[model samples]
Target chain A: MAKTPLDEIRSSQVWRSIFRHGYPDTERNRTLAALSNIFLHLHPVRVRKSGLGVRYTWCMGGLTFFLFLVETITGILLMFYYRPTGDAAYNDIAALRDHVPLGVMRELHRWGAHAMVVSVWLHMFRVFLTGSYKPPREFNWCVGVILLVLTLLLSFTGYLLPWDQLAIWAITVGSNMARATPFLGHEGPGASALSVHGLPLIHSSDDARFGLLAGPLVGEGALLRFYVLHCILIPFVASILMAVHFWRVRKDGGISGPM
Target chain B: MLSLLLAEGHGGGLIPAPVRSAIDRLCDPQYFLPLFFVAFVAGLVFYRKWTQPKVAGGIALAALAGFGLALTNHNFLEIVERPDNIPIVGMLGLVAFFTWYSLRLAAVNDERIEKGEGPIEKTGSNDRVLVWPDLVFSEFIALILCTVLLVVWAIAVKAPLEDPANPFKTPNPSKAPWYFLGLQEMLVYYDPWLAGVVLPGLIIVGLCAAPYIDFNPKGNGYYTFKERRFAISAFLFGFLNLWVVMVLIGTFLRGPNWNVFGPFEKWDVHKVVVLNNVNLSEGFWIGWLKTGFPAWFGASPANGSLAQAGNVIARELPGLVLVLLYLAVPPPVLASTVMKGFYKRMGFIRFNLLVFLMLSMMCLPIKMILRWTLNLKYLVAMPEWFLNI
Candidate 1:
């Protein structure tokens, strides 16, 4: 019988040749070999290398990725029921929690976001403690740091999407807070008559907020902007960076061991 | 406070009525059954890949089946509806049981390994548990404590879901969470752009880049403050100084309308006097320039009736000193000390860089403090010539 593409991909001799390792005799070895395969490349490679245990570092980076995956899955599931319009966004979120078939997705996404921030910080802390950022791994550390910021940005941008009171005010206060950046600050240089070539880009109290929200405070445009950023833009950027982060870890000779 | 507690009791516990309903709804069998089944399946999969794989997997599967049966028979729904505090009690009991079970499991596993009969075969080449026992124990304790505290807090003080957030009725003090108080506090001191965007951006960037910045491998497993004493001290000093300045500004300097606790309510006299007395143009420019002074001289500007002027001087001085120190101190110090002392002291380069980074971090607090001392009204009142970006 002829095989399907997925079946062929799964059972192809070339796939088996490249991926399957060991004698393939023992159950344990077979499991390990399967995990090590290119098809299952998402999992870390098996090695006898050791320094500190999972207890010390708690696999924070991996756990953070796990939480991110959880968020993405749940977030996408949420979009199925959620409407991003001003009139419906808040009500939709409420309905997801109060009326939808699987409302736990919302709570999971919310809690997962908080957990991701924590796990990412701990990951960075663990990396710091292990002195993993030294020499050859310095660039990777920088990339990891940028990933951290993107994670926070993802959370901050997403905070407004639900259109709840907490979401609304938090973003308002957050954006209001953004108005204090030097050039971007509302009271800063470009915010006043003080300008270059007489172009008043940010020349009023509302300018910074206006630019951020794409208008005066959180409105329809702001909702859509935040929705795009949260679901599509930031996550896409984060995933690409995360891929680099993981690949660099391999390039940097795996996780740094204790001195 | 006691009266408030009594009043709250009369109103029906700390948990708001709506939130209680939400909790009740969450505890329903419809919610629990699906969640439990999912967790059971996941746990089974994970267990299957590890020690006693088949047995653990079987038990998890059986548990899931039992739960499903109960759900179908309406038995679980009856248990949920009974409301004899059984759910809470059961959860607590489950937590206690799990704690005991895990400890026993660990002991048994350790005994097995010690007896030369390992609990599970080392299947994968990388399957060796990399986690240190001490770290594991510490984490376990921490997790247990955090869980207990969170559960207790949730039960004790039910957080009232605030009236679904209304945008138009902006609160008098529309602040972020307490963690962000340090930053929000800065809005009182610095330009909103600096407070809101640049400073926070720097801090986040700094935190992210921390592993890269302090790249010495000599201090693994040691606390940062203990191993890299000077660098850590400098960083802490910078963090605390900025935090203090911001908090002070948030607490005292914000206008009367925004004052949450009014200890310095009468101190509006100072604002009135400054508003009435100081020449806006001369003071503003002089103030702006003074921000650059304490860097030249090691001494900070004095505080009191001249606090506004002193603050201006104090804030700018540190920044100026920091810039000069970065440019001048390192190369000269390196040349005189490390270069002269040893031929192969590439380590000194790292040390100097670390010091420079720490010093730069200190500048954040300096900038924050200066901005705080300047107060919001001044920034609002200042003409373009006096304002420095």
Candidate 2:
């Protein structure tokens, strides 16, 4: 048989270097294809037949991670047209919506975020109902719990990016809760008890809420602070935690099944 | 026929005025919350029959149809159509579907176990599949579908952006993000300290502690409600009843000034219900006992004397004592009675931790009842120290 151009490319050194395996038709090549690829390696070379059912797993966890990627891509595009300042934030979003081409990236990011939250909750629920958190998986469950909290915090911080009435007020109501953080908050339970020599230590300007918002109220400072958290800080932390979560899934003997 | 029924006007839809009004009344948090909770529990209790494939599908279809019918009502349509609130609508559908799906699987597994067979998952455990095509291909397809769905959703519904940030004019009934709405609703019954900070903190800790606390080895790695009934029921109660239901209430039912509105009711800016709330101290000292507050209890902190602190504590003596008893007494009593198995399995420290968390979870509902029944504001209110619970 004459060698086709496709076969020639496949036999080429550059192609060979990039893809260590040929077409994953045979069993050995199939295993090599998965084992050699970085992304595909996240899954084991083989899985239990029961674990492959969409009904058995719901695939909510994968959907959540996929949504996170959607958010990240659209979010990066949005950042090109956005500013976190109180002055420009709203106009930037307006511009993105009304002017920029395919600017509905904002909508995608926002909706994807909402979807991610729902998916994460469903993922946790599925894990719980299946007793996937039992015994050896306990520590990973703790890590997953933390990841859930991070996801919420990511969404919460992102809520303030638009700097609209809905954004500010919702954040105001949320961050206001920090003002009542036990002894750390100015108006909390033991605030008065934390006084020294008849002088109170914690106050409005230097309390847990102040630290969160970078000011007494959710204003410019808060907008900037939340922007950093939403864009950089929380995502950074979440990615690391996610790595641990996925690693432990494999380490703890792949997708769980009845023994 | 559908269009005729859905014709909109002053009466909203084909639903008669009296029926709509009755629904409006039923939607009140006082009535709605408990009913939602009871229905959820009943569904779980009767999971076997209800989770049959045909029955579950029928119920799900009926629910969707009813929801479709509700959207014909102008007010309901307005609330549900808001782009930000749309996911919540989607969530209701998704949650219902998953609940049915998971329960159906559990039902199947339970039946198999009863018939001297293994769980469905166990049946094909030895049969392995290749990750290269089987898993990876499915994942790639899922990724493509998800992307297409998101892109279509983005184009169809514009993301919500109201007027720019204005510090002077706060929105009436300002709400937290959808997920935190459960905590926000809790704020109605408890102090921000408890509702916002402490409870959320405890929830994370409790979730993390669940695996350690639960000693059941029967239901490991499979869906079997019969074997893990208590654990499954408790989690559903927390997730569906406490969390998701509260989010739904906050998104749809809560209106201007944080008042509950019916699905068909207008979100009237001027709508007001009598608050007339009183704290426990006032209720104890003046309302019930008909006596004056202790003078030193309200003493100015200008002196900042230790004696004033003592008086403040003394003033809240009744509330303080009751709260102490509530926290301190439950473990031993529960260990000896209802949770005897739990205590035995979890042992001293784990058992106490479990009970403590459970009791803390109960506090939210208990406080909610007190608020509804007595118009009680706080169990322990100390303005001088800015302490309340």
Q: Please name the candidate that would achieve the greatest DockQ relative to the true structure.
A: 2
True lDDT of residue B244, candidate 1? 34
DockQ (C-alpha) of model 1?
Answer: 0.25
* Candidate 1 residue spans exceeding 4 A from truth: A1-40, A100-102, A184-186, A190-201, A204-209, B1-166, B177-180, B204-217, B220-227, B231-360, B363-389
TM-score, cand. 2? 0.97
Q: What is candidate 2's lDDT per residue for B20-96, written digit by digit as tens? A: 88999999888998998888888988999998888888888888887777778878878888889989999988998
| Candidate 2 local lDDT, A101-121, one digit each (tens) | 766788889999999999999
lDDT for position A85 in model 2: 89
Estimate candidate 2's alpha-carbon lDDT, on a 0 to 1 scale: 0.89
Model 2 residue runs over 4 Å out of place are: B1-11, B295-304
Highest lDDT against the true fold, candidate: 2
Relative to the true structure, candidate 1 reaches a TM of: 0.58
Q: What is the TM-score of each candidate against the true structure?
A: 0.58, 0.97
Tell me the whole-model lDDT of each prediction, alpha carbons only. 0.53, 0.89
